[model samples]
Target: MANARVDRLRMMLAREGLDAVVLSHPHDVRYATGYHSILERWTQMEPFAAAIVFADPARPAILVIPEANLGIVAVLNRDGPHCTFDEIRSFDMLNFCEVSRYVDPDRNGGQLAEDAMAIAGAIRGTCQPDIAAAITAALADHGMAGKRIGFDEHRVSAAVAPKVPHDYRDALDFMMRVRVVKTGEEIERYRAVGRMADRVIAHAGSLLHEGADWNGVQAGICDFMVRNGVIPVDEGAMLFGGSYDGDDFIPDLFRTPGKRALRRGDIVILETQGVLDGFWIDINRTAVIGRPSADYQRLHDILRDAFLMMVDRLRPGVSTNSLPAIGYEHLKAKGVPAPEKLLVVAHGIGLMPLEIPLAYPAAGLAGVKQGFVMEEDMLISLDSLFFGAKLGPCHMENVYAITAGAPEPMYAAPLELIVADHAPADRASEPA
Candidate 1:
């Protein structure tokens, strides 16, 4: 699996015109080498460490990983070269001579240990003061006094002393420039996750009722994701009732479901999660208790059409900004609201649920010249949501790959509203 990923990384290196690239970021490291923690003790102390990738157009790929992670590296590359291993205990500048062979292939011996020292210093300060002290000595021994290297500005702290010069790029950009686009195997795994989410959501929808509480719904969906092969231990799903009705309600950043039972005329927004190989697919669907009003139905129709129209615009050469514009025109032509003002277009989705190359627009985002260029293999989400003042919440969601032609929806669950028939026994006096 990682052999293919390494090949893609080499291609990226060639495109970027970089001689060799080092990956100390956990996500980047995983993308390149598929090395996860077998050394739980050291991982807890320094969970964010990774190996450097030195790509030479002429030679084979070389990776520098921790000695404890050798097993993972071995499994990741059963058919490829055993990646070079560096012991974490002696990770300072003094012991970096071994890495020089991989880093500076032309040099006979001498340590260009600036990056290792900087990485050691950064991880040392996290929770383990003892490790911090040890890595401080490593930097001094390595002679990484002055060198230009790229680091994640978003992650690297202000307190850490700068041992080397750094290039500032948004951490999202650095990662997505390499990862936003998926490989054939990655897309297959992603499709599997989406199918799992679709089945789980469908099962949850079938078991719904007017008396069902938020916990009941969440329990069913959670079990389904786990049974159908999704990483079950994430933050899980959020069930919104009538409490968060306004535009100010940011949906579920950190809110859990309440004791509110399903009632007649209530719209239930189900945002279930699916994970395959650490990549994520978030698909949200709205289920209505009893049939909805004509006005609510109208909004759902408009949003559905708009969602398809926006997704149809994705291709290899189109701009990310064009998505929101097309969605706006789509809704406007149908006599609905604008996409930007309504916030109902597509967005980026990947390992973190939301990646960069966002499909939406913002002020000063025009001419930013960033985001998905609709390149082949880029995985993104096309989600259209409607928050009605007269009704409740509605969402149509799917994952898409930017191909040479049209965008492909990874998950193909029903796009329209799923209506449930039941009367609210406790709210007989309430008006619809």
Candidate 2:
């Protein structure tokens, strides 16, 4: 299945008129070659591995890794279904030293040698060349170094840019487009994320009420997520939009939790979004403190129906531009008001959470527009919200895997408005 994924990427590269690509972005690297780097720890200075993905299926792919990580192959088992790369180029910092050029106390002080291995046995130091240089050199050796190469522009080190020609294009978007569809192993990883989301969302529900601080709820949710091994990412945030408390539209749907306290009858919207391994779980849950508004309850029903209606129409040939209106019209026909800048009701979520082919409400939608077709095995996240007066502006966001039959839920939380226990936390005066 992983090979099938890489094969798809190769096909895309061929279509784009590129011969080869160097993938160093952790997500793209893992997607192209099933070698999972440290989860949520992707940095510019990666010391472990990188992969050179080729556009031709018959041609073998290449991999560059630090020598220390060579032993990791025993556990990772890249020789089998995990990856398709055949050539392995290992770099050893220990080889960088001229031990004989230095003075050795034990050997009559002639030119002495001290490399990484020798230093580990005695001294310590840092190496100069990065993995990018080796990547550039490998591409050059293959005779495609000056051709239009596809590489992660952000990961291309200053040492490598000069080596690679000006024609090199950014490959992150193309790679992500290829990764929109999840393989069997990738879906299984998301299943684990589904489990984590259920527990974490339930935990957050128990702590909501008047006087419950936004930050406090965030802290409790973090503890639950961490306990379940769903380590959090700083860039990826858990949000709570105090929509009803404030007047007008909630300008930012991703408003982070803070010192603001929950008021009586305020609509509490919690979005549990995080990545597990490379898969993702993006869930939206809406609840109320005390009594609920009839309009809010009605809006929830309309949103729910609209969401289901869109899911029902999702098939291989369905147009991406057709989705948003399907959802938006359902809400509007049912008397639910559409909020300002209501866009991207649905999007593909896999490697980076928001992939492409976003569905817009109007004709001139500004995303991956009309002609793009939905395919089998594409993972999507639907975000539906209603911003009206009093209580919520209800929202329901969930991740689903598009199947030949019906879309499979990554994790199914309660769709109804959760009426929590009337217990208040700390102290607060309700807004007059």
Candidate 3:
């Protein structure tokens, strides 16, 4: 799998006249190499790690890792479709942390180390500069000493940057361009995860009651997913519920969950975010606590139409820049109000919820440049968050992967307004 990814990257890099590239950012490293650790979430330090990819097939990719991470990274790639890098180089922070102690950092600690010297000369050859030397040695050995090098310039480490003897271009650009599409293996993983998340959404919708707090609904969904082997553990994995009772929806969709209680006739927005294996799904569905109002049905119908209209155009040959006009024409045909503001109505999804091929200001789709062209095997989510004071807010989202024939929805959920009524035994006095 990684071989295919590397091949695709090599072709793109060749176009840009780059001889080799290195990955240092966590997400890029994970996607390119399939070597992920919970520790990669560090905001301050990533232990200054990197994974190198040389354009020359004869020369293998190398990982510049802190001596501490070598063993775990090896075990991580042991049975997975991870990068088959030929070399792994190690660096040491002799004072704050020792290379010897990292042989089994979390497990045996110093127990894994053999007798070491007490003199400073013993550790003199192991320091920050040593990390650069290791990388430079690889480049010199490969005849790439003065070739164009690619890396995330912002995240580059001083200890690691000066060793490169060539021009630097942001590796992020190439990565984003290629990440728009999903491979067969990635699509399968996403479908499995979306299925699990769909069940969690349905189960949580069933558990909604007139008086239940958002916390209960979130817990119900998360616990169900975890217990059923969807999420491996409770590592801050979550679900969110918002009581958008009478235009109270949090426009910023990613706000943290609160104890807002569901009242009668309230439109409960439940978003289920689940991680299966390593893939993620971002799905949202609105359900009413009791009977939904006429406006609820109207909003659901119009938004679903808008969403489907956008999705229908998500074919391999389609230009993503045409989404807004397609949506406008569809709304006009359906006699629904034309959306005044079109946000990220469609976007690609993969190892993360949002990937490349995204719409609007960032990709300049809504303005100057023609948007990203859809390629085969791209996974995307068509979203509709159209709203007005009179129309109320309805958030509808679903996942799909573009194919040669037609795109396919990952979930089995029907695109309709779900009227979720609480059982009599669970009912209580309606709140204002």
In model 2, where do residues sit more than 4 Å from their true spots?
Answer: 36-49, 68-85, 91-128, 143-148, 154-169, 235-237, 243-252, 337-344, 357-365, 368-371, 422-432
Candidate 1 achieves a global lDDT of 0.55
Across 206-293, the per-residue lDDT of candidate 3 in tens digits comes to 7777777666666666677777766522332444345343435443355455535667776666566766667776777777777888
C-alpha local distance difference test of each model: 0.55, 0.64, 0.63
The runs of at least 3 residues in candidate 3 whose Cα sits more than 4 Å from the true structure, single-residue gaps closed, are 45-48, 77-83, 93-133, 154-161, 225-260, 341-344, 357-370, 424-432
Candidate order by decreasing TM-score: 3, 2, 1
TM-score comparison, 2 vs 3, better candidate: 3
What's model 1's TM-score? 0.69
Q: With candidate 2 superimposed using the best TM-score fit, by how many Å does residue 200's alpha carbon deviate from the native?
A: 2.1
Clashing pairs in 1: 92-138, 93-138, 93-142
CA RMSD, predictions in order: 10.4, 7.8, 6.2
lDDT tens digits by residue: candidate 1, 242-338? 3333323223434465446666676777667656566775787877777889988987888788777777877778776666666567666766543
In candidate 2, how many Å is residue 144 off?
A: 3.3
Q: Predictions ranked by lDDT, top down?
A: 2, 3, 1
